[model samples]
Target: MKEKIIIIGAGVSGLVAAINLEKAGFNSVILDQSDRVGGRVKTDYREGYQFDHGFQVLLTQYPAAKKYLNYNLLDLVEFDPGSCIFYHQKKYYIGDPSRKLSLLFPTLLAKIGNVADKLKILKLSKALKKKSFDDIFLAPETTTLVYLKEKGFSDEVIKKFFKPFFTGIFLESELTTSSRKFEFVYKMFAEGSAAIPKKGIQAIPNQLAAQLKNTELEFNTSVEHIKANELVLTNGKTLAFDYCIIAAEAWPIIANLKNQESAWKSVENLYFKVKEKVIKKPLIGLIADEAALVNNIHYQPIKKSDNYLLSVSVIKQHNLSKDELINRVEEDLAIYCDIKVDSFVKYFKIKKALPVMHTVNYMMPPSETQLKDRIFLAGDQLSNGSLNAAMLNGESAARAVIAKIKNGFINVN
Candidate 1:
């Protein structure tokens, strides 16, 4: 008889784990508390406009993504391999000259970075390309800020470009994220373009979830407790399984397991609909001012439409109400463009948007897939908090389960 597997939480990791186990000829059941399959990645439509839970982008060349996701089916919309930085009351364009040779001199001439800093970027790019992905992760680790300083990057460049860009990406202001993670992220950018599915980021997970053949999905069914031989559901029912995978975030898993918790960063996203396009091109505008209410603004382009969908990410989390925060963001954005505050379509405040990665814990061992007592864990926090890490770790845990089953169920504590 095929081994029975129960996977808790229907996020990307849980879904991926189920898919892999089913493909390997195991009977799998996926249980989720929420009604939606896409946990963090979700989209809502209202009044003829679409808004994601938060500002998100998919790197077209994420190594793990290519292994499963079909890029053509995603119908991706690629952004230019550049960014428009709003600095000192002016907008500056910094682009990859390699793709468009014409922008080589202009990007260097732009005030975003000095000649030396620009040269360092190219040097770092080439160096990263040469190093294997594993080597980059295992290299000497430190805070990203210190790593930049050690690499001879100028303060101007770190502040103007690196700080704002990374702050928006990592959802942190101190730039204390692991340098190794920074290296990996930079390598991905150097290799591919950042884009989103024409539908939404949810499309990525939805595509993965659609491939299950022998897996049973129980939506709105929460698992209260996990055990070595069975799972206790919130509705006072227990289901038996040979192997169980806990694929939720670290905090949720820690709470259930009664373990210490890790810190996470929050984000406040506000979406606006404009009558006409504000930024001419579909590019991200990094707010250079550190004290500003808005960290970055992305102008989402709709095919053959003059109307614009603006997604703004706010780094600071204040106790102010939604209207108050929206007012502040509108005031700051007015300096750059003429926008109506009343044009706001939706707002999303995500408390645990990103898992913080400090240098001290950056290289620590990933969460144990096979617990001493026979349980398993999977999530982005086990690696770094990225879509690629979540999917990869899920598959790794599934393989571990398969191997254990093949070996005839090891000793259980």
Candidate 2:
């Protein structure tokens, strides 16, 4: 008989786990608290405008991501990180991509200040992934700034590079997240292509979800509890299973973590539609070292609609009123692209920001978790919090469970 498995959280991780379980010849039931799958990978289309709630880009080189993301069907829009506009003091300054600070400040070049500072970045890149959170928690995650400072990067360079780049990620403008996350992201940015999806970020999770037609998906259902080999439902029913896998976010994990302290992080997203007269091509912007400012802007061009879509991500609280958020970001767009943004038709905000991955606890534990047996923990957070991570981790967790089941089910060779 096929072993019965119960999976929780119909998000990206949950679906991946369910699909992998089916591949291993196990029948599993996937349960989620929300009405849909995709978890943080949400897209809100308002008046033909598209907005991705969390996680916008994926690198083809990401070890785990390359394994699951459909390479045959999904195409990535390459990023021109070589051309980044830095918005500081309400002005947009173009910075050089080859670690040259002189492009931002020529005067510093003559003082041996900029010339010498450039070498520091070149040096750090040489030694990025020597450690990968195997068993070390040396420093407390303050912000990305302190990590940069400790690495010998000057404040000026931090503002021009680290500020807009890293801050936009964690929603903490100052980079107060853990250095481990900081180090890993920097390496990815510097080395990987900042490719957005050709269609949109939703293509990844959406395509992944579509492939799960063979598996049973229970949407809008919540798991109340599990006890004595039975899965309890919010509707007061129970599901009996041979094994259960949890692919929910940290909130659900911590809730069932029992005695352990629950872990959480917060992210914010602001999206808008630009005037027709705005920039023609889509461009991404990274904010300077400013906390109240947005870390980056991802704009999309849709000629069919006569409007352009734009999303502003600010980890920290942004100082923009309803109208102000739209107007200010539009203003910043003008500075970065040299085209006025007031030409667009309309805009809206989807505040479903969340802890995509945060300081301190963004550290992923083993998929098996601290449990004795039977129960397995898996999710995007279980790996490194990406569409690929979720899928790969889910497969691995399912494999681990199936391996144990095979030993008991199969005849000796």
For this target, which candidate reaches the highest lDDT against the unseen true structure? 1
Candidate 2: which stretches are off by over 4 Å? Answer: 88-113, 129-143, 250-261, 276-283, 289-292, 318-340, 343-367, 370-372, 408-413
Q: How many backbone clashes does candidate 1 have?
A: 0
Task: Give me the candidate number with maximum TM-score.
Answer: 1
Report the C-alpha lDDT of model 1 over 295-381, residue by residue, as the tens digit. 889866662254577889998767788899988888888775445543887899888787776542222122347764456777677
lDDT of 2 by residue, 1-413 (tens): 46778788777677777777776666678887776777767666555555666547776656556666776587777655433444433333343345444344532332222555666765665455354433223446555677778777777777676666666565556566667666666566555666766666777777777776556778878877667577778898888888778776434433455665445455556555555533222345665635334567666645445555566665556556757766765665555544455344444343443344454333233434424367777776654545555666677667666766776431211
Q: List the residue pairs that clash in candidate 1.
A: none
Which 10 successive residues of model 1 have the least lDDT summed?
359-368
Using all chains and alpha carbons, the TM-scores for the candidates as numbered come to: 0.93, 0.79
State the local distance difference test value for candidate 2: 0.60
Those runs of model 1 whose alpha carbons end farther than 4 Å from true positions after fitting are 250-256, 303-306, 336-342, 359-368, 409-413
* TM-score of candidate 2 relative to the true fold: 0.79
